[model samples]
Target chain A: SAVISQKPSRDICQRGTSLTIQCQVDSQVTMMFWYRQQPGQSLTLIATANQGSEATYESGFVIDKFPISRPNLTFSTLTVSNMSPEDSSIYLCSVARDGTYEQYFGPGTRLTVT
Target chain B: QQPVQSPQAVILREGEDAVINCSSSKALYSVHWYRQKHGEAPVFLMILLKGGEQKGHDKISASFNEKKQQSSLYLTASQLSYSGTYFCGTETPGGSNYKLTFGKGTLLTVNP
Candidate 1:
């Protein structure tokens, strides 16, 4: 199991602004992913952040709106740009360690866009 | 594609038993179970690979039926601390990338 942490556990941001959420893992991971959970909704995978490569985003999500960066194996960040009330949700970062089928998640960053 | 999990929500009394099911339309390489308390991140419970191997921790156990392309999580003697949303994530065949597509989730409420 890997220990994961995120910056800005909770934040209140103004509409039209962007907020970057950071994820760090205690151990090196083979893959990292970002997910969004709107109020009363299930989690939606935003993208897969691979080290030294561009992140692969899922359908209904695009890089222009949610840019992701993975500078190294243990660190990654997801930025929610041009925020709106619709973007108000909890963003979680997950780490999949090698040899394990499970993905460990950070506490999550709760963004309330007003 | 996201797997299908049911029932959407369940209410159980303390010391009761409950079962959560997760199924996929496509063949699965693996299935993972996670539980998330209100206002907290999802915590990993267990994972079952295609071999139909079962793994258990504490009173929680899970089984993967490769033929059915489904998995089930059994919670015995449920406790009040077990109230939370349960999610099942699956890794598809071919293993191009190991990322998992998670299901909508099953809301489990264990009342004392």
Candidate 2:
């Protein structure tokens, strides 16, 4: 199992502002993913942050809107640019350890756009 | 595409049993189960790979029918701690096999 943590556990940001959430893992991981859970909705994948290269984003999510950076195997960051009320949701980061089939998640960063 | 989960919500008493089903239109290589409490991150439950496998952890178990592109999670003798939203993530045959496409989720409420 992997232990993951995210910064800015909860925040209230004004519309048009930006918030960057940081994810760190206790151990090195090959894959790290960012997800968003809206109110009364299931989790949606934002992008997969790779250690050295560009992140792979899912459809409906663009790199310009949700930029990601993974400088190393143990750390990554996601920036939600020009947020709107619709962007208000719980953002979570998950990591898949080197030899594990299961992916563990961080506590999550709850964002409320006002 | 996202998988579909049945019985959007369910209420159960302690020691009771419950089953949540997940189905997809596309062929699946694996099915992963996870549970998330209110305001908490999802926790991994179990993963059932292809070849029609059944995996279990503690009082929880899951079966994947690769041919049917469906999976079911069984919670036996459920405890209060079992109350949470359960999600089933499906992995397709190719392309980003490690990435999971999650279902809408089934909310399970266990009361003492």
Candidate 3:
């Protein structure tokens, strides 16, 4: 397991604005991911952030909507662009252990778009 | 595709036992179990890899039947702390690691 922390633990933003969530891991990790959990819903993977390459996003999630930046192995960011009321959800950052199958998740960023 | 979880909700009393089931329509390479409490991030409980050994910790255990594309999570001697939503994430063959298709969560409420 890894210690992960996300910045701006909680935020309320206007519908057409944007908010960037940051995730930092305790040490270098190879796999970092962003997920969204809507109220009363399961987690939806946004993208996979590799240290040196562009993120691989899942279907229905576009880079323009949720752009990701993985500057290094220990840090990454996710920007929810042109937010909407539907964008209100808990954004979580997770990391797969260096060699294990289990993943550790950050506390999460609670974003509420009005 | 997303897997299906049974008993969308279950209520258990302390010391009781509960079983949560997860099944996929497609073949799976692995199954992951996670528990999430309200207002908190989901925590990994364990991962069951295909052709690998079944896993358990203390009072919690799980099994995967690769042939059936199904997995079950068993909680023995339930505790109040076990009250939360449980999710099973499935990875099909050739799927990327850490990229899972999650099932609709099963709500487990363990009352003291």
Error of 3 at B110 (Å): 0.9
Fnat values, one per model, are 0.77, 0.73, 0.83
CA shift of A56, model 1, Å: 0.9
- Candidate 2 local lDDT, residue A32: 93
Mark the regions of model 1 whose C-alpha exceeds 4 Å error after superposition.
Answer: none
The better-scoring model by TM-score among 2 and 3 is 2
What does candidate 1's lDDT look like per residue over B1-112, in tens digits? Answer: 7899999999999999999999999998899999999888899998898558788888999999999999999999998988999999998988556688889999999988
Which has the better DockQ: candidate 1, or candidate 3?
3
Any idea what lDDT model 1 has? Answer: 0.90
- Please provide, for model 2 over B1-112, each residue's C-alpha lDDT reduced to its tens digit, 9 standing for 90 to 100: 9999988999999999999999999999889999999988999998888658998899999999988889999999999999999999988887953788899999999999
The deviation in Å at residue A29 for candidate 1 is: 1.5
Task: Give the CAPRI class of candidate 3.
Answer: high
Cα DockQ of the candidate 2 complex? 0.86
In model 1, pairs of residues that clash are: none
Enumerate clash totals for all models, in the order shown: 0, 0, 0
lDDT of 1 by residue, A1-114 (tens): 889999989999999999999999998886899999885678788888888778888889999999999998899989999999899999999988777757899999999999
Relative to the true structure, candidate 1 reaches a TM of 0.95
**lDDT score at residue B64, model 2, on the 0-100 scale:** 92
